[model samples]
Target: MQGTVDSTPVVTGHEVAAHEEHQDLRVLGLITFLASEFLMFAGFFAVFLVFRGSHVQWPPEETEVELLLPAVNTLILVSSSWVINLGTKAIKKNDLAGMRKWFGITAAMGAIFLAGQVYEYMNLGYGLKTNLFSNCFYLTTGFHGAHVFIGLVLILGVLWRSRRANHYNDITHTGPEMAEIYWHFVDVVWIVLFSLIYLLTLI
Candidate 1:
């Protein structure tokens, strides 16, 4: 007589609860870290508002802020955000190759955006010492650029770890999820900062 057997493993209720608890802890920690980062940016925004209010001419007339390069950079960053999201989806589907390819592309786009910013700075006649607007613009945008760099490092770390360990799937991918959410936060902040510096500065 031949007998057939099912090889699937059953998850116990206790194990499910434990996994949920671990996830909650990681999320709580991430929220706390992000709150601090938000407050730091809020301080910079306050300083900018104060300095702008005190000045009669915000950009001092002589300095020109071109909309072309930054507009292109914004498109690049927004596209990178979508790329990272696709990487996350691939990771969830247990597709390591897909995740790596998408995330690599995301990182490359971010690097390009940063390079564009550098080029803009090099070509611009005004600098950090030019005026209040220059100071605020450089400080805020530079700070956001730093965050983008940090997010890129994190994504690279996730990519490296994913390659090393086979733990990340639809089931257990907290580390990658954290990196992706932080990348999302960085992207959102850039949008707000771009609007404030470029669009609102014209007003």
Candidate 2:
């Protein structure tokens, strides 16, 4: 006759349930945080629209925003987003070298975009205090430029850390993921600004 057999693992059912609940909580928290951020940006957009309506032309009849330079900068930003996407994919595949190369290219593109922004600002016929158009143009683009600067710093920090730690992998690359999310947000903001401030002005 055989003795009694114990087939179950040492862990309790409660422990497994707790772990799943914690994961679900974290996901919900992240979604809530993103929603709040969306609302804040929405408020800013509303204010901009109100101010824009006060202008003679949507972007000002007397002063025109140069489409050529902004167009180039927009292309650069879009390319940077692409590079960061590649970098994220490489990190998932555990290809540190590929990640580093792509991130570096992305950083370079960001710098180019920033430089173009400065050139456009300098060449704009009006200063920030000139009129409603100038104020809106500077405020919107300046805010976005500041975000680019911050993103650049973040990318550089990631590059430096990646050299020493193998922290990014298929299952754990949250830093890069968050950075990409922020970068994409910045890109989308610029696209909206370009359409409203540049393209729509022509019509």
**Best-fitting candidate, scored by lDDT:** 1
Candidate 1, TM-score vs. the true structure?
0.85
Off by over 4 Å in 2: 1-34
Each prediction's Cα lDDT score? Answer: 0.85, 0.79
Clashes of each: 0, 0
Strongest candidate by TM-score: 1
Expressed as tens digits, the lDDT of each residue in 1-203 for candidate 1 is: 24767644556676775665423478668878998998899899889878778878876787768789999999999988899999989989998888889989988998999999999999888899987788888999999999999998998898788767686887777877788889888988888888877877677
**Candidate 2: tens digits of C-alpha lDDT, residues 57-165:** 6766666789898998999998789999999999899888888899899889999999999988888778899887787778878887887898888888878888777
The 10-residue segment with the lowest total lDDT in model 1: 15-24
Once superposed on the true structure, which residue ranges of model 1 sit more than 4 Å away at CA? 1-24
lDDT of 2 at 139: 80
Q: List the pairs of residues colliding in candidate 2.
A: none
